[model samples]
Target: MKKNLSISARLTLVMILLLAVIYPLLIAAVGKLTPGKGKGETISVNGKVVGYERIGQKFTADIYFQGRPSAVDYNAAGSAGSNKGPSNPGYLQLVQNRIDSFLAHNPGVTKEQIPSDLVTASGSGLDPHISPDAARIQIKRVASSRGISMQKVTELVQAHIVQPVFGPAYVHVLKLNVALDEIKH
Candidate 1:
């Protein structure tokens, strides 16, 4: 028993050193090779920093295209999902409320036309990208609110679609909103 205890203690010490120290160092080293070096990729406009590329922003105004409903209310400091399953009554009720709110803001848009991404919060609660379809669905409301033609709004949404190498296309909501502000007409 004495020998077994000694072995266990040594193994635990080795694991702690390996996982708690060395692993983090290795990850940081790898992160240095990526864009923003794992700190965050900032989106700037006219030399003013607006937001991070990976963190979503809340745009509730009718003139702006809203991003996903954030479980953390787009608070980067407290990123998380609702963690409620689909069958959970509270979760369903929350989604229903979101759908209703979206319809109220976007007149002439049917519930079926609204994409799920527009109504559901992402797992991270900080996803910056929304599906192209999600952005498209909002063009009508945004154009009307901004007094721009739907064609111009659609063109802007199409220009912002990012076809990543590994996943489906998505548009950065912050980028889109910034461009929307730049439109003189």
Candidate 2:
């Protein structure tokens, strides 16, 4: 019994060192190679740090493009989705309210033309990217609100499209808005 206990203790220590210490060190080393070195990647304009590229921000102004709906109210510390099922009455009403508000702000946009990402909170509620269709849908509103031409804003959105190696193209909402703000038009 003593011998078995000794071996078990030794194995436990070894496993803990290997899994907890070594594995985490390796992950940290890899993270160091990323853009932010384990910290969040920030987007800057003219040396001014605007926001992090990885976290979504709330943009209620009609002149700026909006990101996905956040159940946590753009509170990065409390990242979460609404967790309400599609069949839930409360969730349906919430989506309906978003749709109505979006329609009111965008006179020409129809309910069907609205992208799912525009009204639904993502699983993490921190997604900073939106589908191209989502950005395009708001182009008219943003252009008109900012007194910029639709063509220029559309070009900006097109320029910001990021095509992942395996997924559909998306535009980073914060980056797009920042770029839009910088444009002379």
Candidate 3:
């Protein structure tokens, strides 16, 4: 029994050193090699940082492409979803409210045409990307609002499509909106 107790103590110490200490250091080292070097990737325009590319930003204006709904209101520090299931009344009501608001701003968009991503917050609540369908659905509104042709907006959305190996293409909404601002009508 005494030998077993000693073995457990040594195991615990090893685990603490490996997981608690080494693991975090390893992660930080890896982060240092990334684009932001531990900070998130920032999108800049005119030598000024507008927003992070990996985190969502709230863009309610018709002239900008909107991202996924965020339960935490785009607060990166408190990234989280609503934690409500699909059948829950509150969740359904929330989705309906989003749909209504989206339609109100997007004049001709139908309820069916609205992508699920636009009405439902992602699990992390900080998704900067949305389905290409979601971005395309808003092109008309954005084009009209910016006084640019729909063809140009379509080209922008097509240019930003990110095709992952396992799923359909998605567009980074923040990048799209930044490009929108750069376009001269």
Q: Who wins the TM-score comparison?
A: 2
Candidate 2 structure quality by residue, lDDT tens digits, 1-185:
99999999999999999999999999999999998998778888889887887888898989899988888888788888889987999899999999999999999998999999899989888888899999999999999998879999999999999998998999999989888888963
Ranking by TM-score: 2, 3, 1
Q: Least accurate stretch of 10 residues (summed lDDT) in model 3?
A: 176-185
Candidates sorted by lDDT, best first: 2, 1, 3
User: lDDT of each prediction vs. the true structure?
Assistant: 0.90, 0.91, 0.88
Give one digit per residue, the lDDT tens place, for model 3 in 1-185: 99999999999999999999999999999999998999778889998998887788888777788888888888888888889887999889988998998889989889989888888888888888899899889989889988889999999999999998998789988898888788873
lDDT of 1: 0.90
Q: Which stretches of candidate 1 lie over 4 Å from their true place?
A: 1-23, 26-30
Tens digits of per-residue lDDT for model 1 on 61-163?
Answer: 9999888988899989888998888799988998999899888888898888888888888998989889999999999999998898999999999999999
Decide which is better by lDDT, 2 or 3.
Answer: 2
Weakest 10 consecutive residues of candidate 1 by summed lDDT: 37-46
TM-score-better candidate, 2 vs 3: 2
Q: Superposing all C-alpha atoms, what RMSD in Å does each candidate have to the true structure?
A: 2.6, 1.8, 2.2
Candidate 2: segments with Cα more than 4 A from true spot? none
> Which has the higher lDDT value, candidate number 1 or candidate number 3?
1
Candidate 2: deviation at residue 40, Å? 3.0
